[model samples]
Target: MGRRLLLGMLFLLSVKIMAQEKDSRLCLGLNYGFGSEFNNTDYTFINHFYKLQLYYKLSETKHFQYEILIQPEINFAKHQLLNFYFVKPETPDYQQKREDYTQLKEVREYVLNLGFLVRKPIGKSCSVYVLGSIGPMINDTETERMSKGFAFADVLALGFSFKMKKIHFDIRPEIRHVSNAGLSGKNGGYNTRNIEFGVSYSL
Candidate 1:
């Protein structure tokens, strides 16, 4: 993974250097974020993600542009712990078995997303953008010996970007919503919301 990241960065840097003199050229970048899951009682869990984005100018005078963003992520969550903490002994039979005496388990997930954005440049080096995307992802639950796949989940984001000469940098704060369609009804719609921050540099 580290090697892959290093190689990707080097490639993006090369592209930026080559396009420094072009009036209207495409830019590529990388983004990364460190944060925690929301509504998650398990404070011990952490979430991190990485993204790659490409931008192309449509009309230089109008600040019109198009963008593509690719994000791959891993999530470690403990939502089951929250349920266990709230269960009472007086609960019904099924409830007791499912909550009170149930053990807390941790789940891990892997996801890949592809997105598109509409951007309007604000100045010589800045722009504001809105994005929407849908893609397939794989979900793996280690504790339950379960693995599932999903397709066509949606995400929406709003952020900004900065460009200087031949070098382009972007910083976008975004919200991501995902729905996992259960595999054979064994695992169903488990939704997650995340706030992501990313940075990218392109020549």
Candidate 2:
């Protein structure tokens, strides 16, 4: 009787594993972000981006699922400094620095981010998720807050997704920070809040 009970337990475990099988998918979307007071800085920023994503099942349980994401993004941003911190009166170029840092400027960025997502199902076709990612970025314009070259972008988001047939619609609210990780002397970064809408298909 003990042997029979052990065999039954093994069979149930296998069935549970099989029930959680998942497939890969692709997603595309746009994101618009703006600076918020959470950064402890006076500068304000705005950005819009085109996003491409590919994701697959990494793990699962009866109550949760995990996914790995490869996402590439291209964005344009507008920035303006609202404080005198970047311009010190003691500096030789104080006048020039003040003139440069206070003006509105447009910048472009290229990014490739690797993300990990944790999801919980609400029903048959809807779920809530949390996602985090960090990746390399290339900035095309120099600013008082950051340098003009290589940087890192980090993101954390909370999202909801609804699936209809093979199509999935998502809404995500996120916080993002970009810095060069001290690769250069000017490492002050920009922090922003972003809302993203996206659609994905399962293949």
Candidate 3:
């Protein structure tokens, strides 16, 4: 009976040590990004964005890992002008009237998102992952004819990660979409494609 008790204690200790060796509990990351709008024809320059993320490892196996993450992001862009030119005829006469007006300027946007990440390990320290996120977004430029103050945002990303001791680095290419941009009467939404690089510290 004493021999069996000693063996059981030794087994529990080994299991505890194994759990500690495979720990990837929590992570914090920051990323920088550069991107451009996909459907905008008038924009001349690519935009700059930044993100801060917090991740919690929900579950893991020898080959796969799953995480839940929250990210807050912001984007900065150049101001743009929308011009409308109209030509009208007065009293059905030969004379014509022409008028032009400027509409709205594109500015900055802020987003807060919650997402899930699925990672598959390829080697000891290298992995590939995919992520999807959805949340709320706000833009600086909100007008009757343009995007609203609140909108729904969605993100999709594919990336690779390299783990080093307690630190991990990631490079991801992502696509983001905003629905009902500016609550504008025209209902023209927004879409962007970007690449992001991030460094994270694991706990």
Candidate 4:
């Protein structure tokens, strides 16, 4: 009787493993979003972004599972503002323009990024995640650029992942904050936010 019981247990375990394997999924995807930056001194700028990625899942179904994401992105920036100081006595009409001492200008930037993500499932078809990355931006202006160096930033991303049989997709509304982050016309160290959409195919 003991031998029979052991055999039954092994059979059950085998069935469970097969079920999991049949339901497992792996995916590759593309992402697109809009982005912007805000300087430490309150100057503001805007940009749009795009990316391509590879996504992977290690389990079939779980309240929590491990995730891996590799993505490359491109960001385009514009509408930059530059500020300075003008003392009341230094201007032709110092007192008249004293209240408007700062100036605003338009500029543009291009940023390239590479990122890694780890995610946890919060719902049947959704997950929340966080990411960290370092990259560079080639800009069209000076003071607003990456100090002629590489740009660095950290981003927080939250979104839902969806699966249909063996196929899956992900979408995240993300907020990114950078220190010493710039392209060509805008300076580094600012807050940026964007909404991203990604679609994937599992192997």
Measured by lDDT, the strongest candidate is: 2
Ranking by lDDT: 2, 3, 4, 1
Model 4 Cα lDDT, one tens digit per residue, 1-203: 99999999999999988767644535667777886664445456676767777665554345456555556666665544344341326546755443442344343444555565666766656666665555555444433333434555556777777777656677787787654532332344557887888777665
TM-score per candidate, in order? 0.61, 0.82, 0.73, 0.60
Which one wins by TM-score: 1 or 3?
3
For model 3, give the 10-residue run with minimal summed lDDT: 92-101
Sorted on TM-score, highest at the top, how do the candidates line up?
A: 2, 3, 1, 4
Location of the lowest summed lDDT over 10 successive residues in candidate 2: 22-31
* Whole-model lDDT, model 1: 0.56
lDDT of 3 by residue, 52-136 (tens): 9898989898888999999998978653333222222432321321121133245677889899999999988999999999988
Model 1 CA deviation exceeding 4 Å by range:
1-25, 34-46, 55-63, 75-78, 84-105, 142-147, 151-153, 186-193
Off by over 4 Å in 4: 1-26, 38-41, 58-62, 86-116, 122-124, 132-141, 180-188
Task: Give lDDT: candidate 3, residue 157.
Answer: 97
Clashes of each: 2, 0, 4, 10
- The better-scoring model by lDDT among 2 and 4 is 2
Ranking 3 against 4 by TM-score, winner: 3
The digit string of per-residue lDDT tens for model 2 on 1-203 reads 99999999999998776654433333444443444425545787888886787777777799998988888988788888888666668867888887888999898989998999999989999999999999999999888888899999999999999988768888888998899999985788988888888887775
- Residue 182 deviation, candidate 1, in Å? 5.2
